[model samples]
Target: MELIQKVLDQPVAVSQPASLRPYNSKLKVHDQILCGKIMHSNFSKLAYSIMQSVGYVHDIRAVLFEYMLL
Candidate 1:
């Protein structure tokens, strides 16, 4: 069987908290918004940058033969 990526790497500091483990479970967080934080996670920041930069430059249509392209 194929293996999937682990969500978190080994914690770098001995003082890492238990709450950090909960941050690795992503299926629980899809499509939800984050509010009122001093800073966001790096992954979340990259995602927002991608969405803002390349989000709506393509169009989709349906016909006898339908397809999606970018």
Candidate 2:
């Protein structure tokens, strides 16, 4: 009963809300690599479609270069 009373008398520790925490803007190495891969995949698909519609085909590297220029 005494131990229980002591515990009860102690104050509870409250954690701050998530919104109060600072945001981490940095991405991990693996996360950065994955994002790059996803972006490259999307750009490749878009370039391929555009080339097909134009009745011409070019190297994937050239298409990617054009996209980077824009």
Candidate 3:
């Protein structure tokens, strides 16, 4: 009861909601899935690039393949 009273006593601040008119929401399920897969692959690529930058001789493709196998 005290918590509820405290919450009610606090002043409420309202912010304008974001407008999403510029975004596309009609994407297919397969497209969304493919986008997710690409995003994951990009993360691996980024890791591979970081590894190469740090002088690791490991093959990125091999590492990515092993990741897929799991």
Candidate 4:
């Protein structure tokens, strides 16, 4: 993975593909979309884990709320 700065301020690290083809989108450094999607998915999992650790509400409700926030 190659770490690069996005828009001069935010630093977003992204995966660097093994090879680049003419039509392949992996070479495009400007697109932070793949990174963003992975981040969101990971964040949701973390939230659910935190909720489960606290364990105030029922297990089902905690999971529902965690997904609903996403």
Candidate 5:
């Protein structure tokens, strides 16, 4: 509960386009898309682990929906 509350209290971190740097300065469009997919997958796994640890695995959808309402 404390961990969840702490996460909820923190403001969202939004990154600007200028702040993003590709792994390879010469990265192609395909590479950029691949990088984005990998990052999304990693974040999803991390979020699932956190919810599982907090015993909210079963209520994940409901929790996210309520949070979005806020």
Candidate 6:
């Protein structure tokens, strides 16, 4: 939880366009779409884990109610 909180609290990091390009390669844009998808999957798992840890609310109905309250 502390690590996740620390990550959330930190300022977003940006990379220079030049640095984002692959070494000696010719892709115009960085693969940000793929990166975003991967991050989304990992974050979803972390959030589910946290939710499970906080309470014995593993049912879909309870999860939805809790999420709605938030």
Please report the candidate that would top TM-score against the real structure.
Answer: 5
Of models 2 and 4, which has the larger TM-score? 2
- The window of 10 residues in a row where model 2 has the poorest summed lDDT is 25-34
Sorted on lDDT, best first, the list reads 5, 6, 2, 3, 4, 1
Question: Candidate 4 vs candidate 5: which has greater TM-score?
Answer: 5
TM-score of 4: 0.26
**Which lDDT tens digits does candidate 4 get at residues 14-50?**
2344244232343232122323443445433443344
Model 2: what TM-score?
0.27
- lDDT tens readout by residue for model 3, 1-66: 664454344432212211422322322221222234434444444444444445552344344444
- Tens-digit lDDT track of model 1 for 1-70: 1111221221112123334434433311321221103234544333333333454211211110122112
The list of candidate 1 runs beyond 4 A from truth reads 1-39, 56-70
Model 3 error, position 68 (Å): 2.2
Task: Candidate 3: give the clashing pairs.
Answer: none
In model 5, where is the ten-residue run with the lowest total lDDT? 26-35
The digit string of per-residue lDDT tens for model 6 on 1-70 reads 7878754444332234536544332221212211233234454444444444555323432344345348
lDDT by residue (tens digit), candidate 2, 7-63: 344433213332453423222221222234434454344444444345453233344
Give a tens-digit lDDT track for model 5, residues 1-70: 7765654444332122422644233332222322344244444444545654567644563444355349
Find the 10 residues in a row with the least total lDDT in model 3: 12-21
Q: Count the backbone clashes (under 3 Å) in each candidate.
A: 0, 0, 0, 0, 0, 0
Runs of candidate 2 with Cα error greater than 4 angstroms are: 1-40, 58-70
Deviation of model 3 at 59, angstroms: 6.8
Candidate whose lDDT is highest: 5
**Predictions in order: lDDT:** 0.26, 0.38, 0.37, 0.36, 0.42, 0.39
The TM-score of candidate 3 is 0.29
* Residue 68 accuracy (lDDT) in model 2: 53
TM-scores, all models, native as reference: 0.26, 0.27, 0.29, 0.26, 0.31, 0.28
**Positional deviation of residue 40's Cα in model 1 after best superposition, in angstroms:** 1.7
lDDT (Cα, 0-100) at 5 in candidate 2: 50
